[model samples]
Target chain A: IAGITQAPTSQILAAGRRMTLRCTQDMRHNAMYWYRQDLGLGLRLIHYSNTAGTTGKGEVPDGYSVSRANTDDFPLTLASAVPSQTSVYFCASSDTHSTGELFFGEGSRLTVL
Target chain B: AQSVTQLDSQVPVFEEAPVELRCNYSSSVSVYLFWYVQYPNQGLQLLLKYLSGSTLVKGINGFEAEFNKSQTSFHLRKPSVHIRDTAEYFCAVKRAGYALNFGKGTSLLVTP
Candidate 1:
């Protein structure tokens, strides 16, 4: 079912460059999220959407922006990439209910030089 | 705001030995707890969760965790570990109407 899929499995971007991390899910989930995983630090939330057209800031939303244009797509954009933004990004989706389990994408490893 | 704390950053154990990963959380209101596993170069996957049921929650891969309200803890335990169990484990808490809060992950290394 391709639960959740992220684009550009891995990438190398120069500092100050703009990049977008695409996330898509076929499950038609109402909620989607973006998170970054770094060494020692666990997964930190970057942005989230409760449903189509509604997005919210998360724990670590700096340097990142997200839009939920539809139920299937939620993309994260970095206006200006920085070395601090270099980390594995994951996309996740969950059903309308918060109690439901979350489905995660493989991940997008971004290296900013 | 809710927060999670994973007591151990790394745990080394041998195959067939029991292992435990401790987790503590602080929140102003009641919350749901979960444990997720991430293999090398992979995304996080749900290992188990503690909702409103019994204290002990059993999940896939023979892993289990117990939720303690007074202690504010949800410790993951596996009676016998396998080489495949080597991975990073995360403890998470979901506050009402909020995103999940994850603690620093615990890297479990199961040696043969």
Candidate 2:
């Protein structure tokens, strides 16, 4: 099963450009999240959606925005990509049962120059 | 809110040797703890989790962890390891209804 699928397995973007990391899950989960992985800094939450039509800011939401228009998609957009934003982005989803078992995508490696 | 600390950033051990990766968390309210393993170029996969009931949780890949409430620790352990076990291990925690807070991650290197 395609639990979670992300677009542009890797991308190279120029600074100040607009880019969106698309994430879709077929598990019909109620929660979705976006996280960035950087060296030494680990994984930091960017944005999240509790369910359809809802979104919330996470720990590191600056320069990023997300929308959950429906149950299957939660795409993260970088209004103005910066070099500092270059990192491996991961999309994850989980059920509302509270075990917090996240099903993650392979990841999108974004390089902002 | 909850925070996780994985004491070891890297661990090196010989094949078939037992290993333990330390993890500790702090939170005012109750927390759910998890351990995830990421193989090269792969997404993080569940190693095990401690929600409630049993303090000792056994997970896939013959890995298990014991949750210590007094010390606020949930350390992952394996009695004997294989080369396939070498990967990046992450310790994460979350208060109910919150995003998971991950540690810096520990890279496990298994040698022959």
Please give the DockQ score of every candidate, comma-separated: 0.78, 0.85
Give the Å shift of residue A61 in candidate 2: 0.5
For candidate 1, the docking band is: medium
Q: Candidate 2, clashing residue pairs? A: none
The 10-residue segment of model 2 chain A with minimum total lDDT is: A94-103
Question: What docking class should model 2 receive?
Answer: high
Q: Which stretches of candidate 2 lie over 4 Å from their true place?
A: none
Q: For model 1, which pairs clash?
A: none
Query: How well is each residue in B43-94 modelled by candidate 1, as lDDT tens digits?
Result: 8899999989799999999999999999999999999999999999999998
lDDT for B95 in candidate 1 is 77
Worst 10 residues of 2 chain B by lDDT: B92-101
Candidate 1 lDDT over residue span A2-93, tens digit each: 78999999999999999999999999899999999899888899999999999999889999999888999999999999999999999999
**In angstroms, how far off is A89's CA in candidate 1?**
0.4
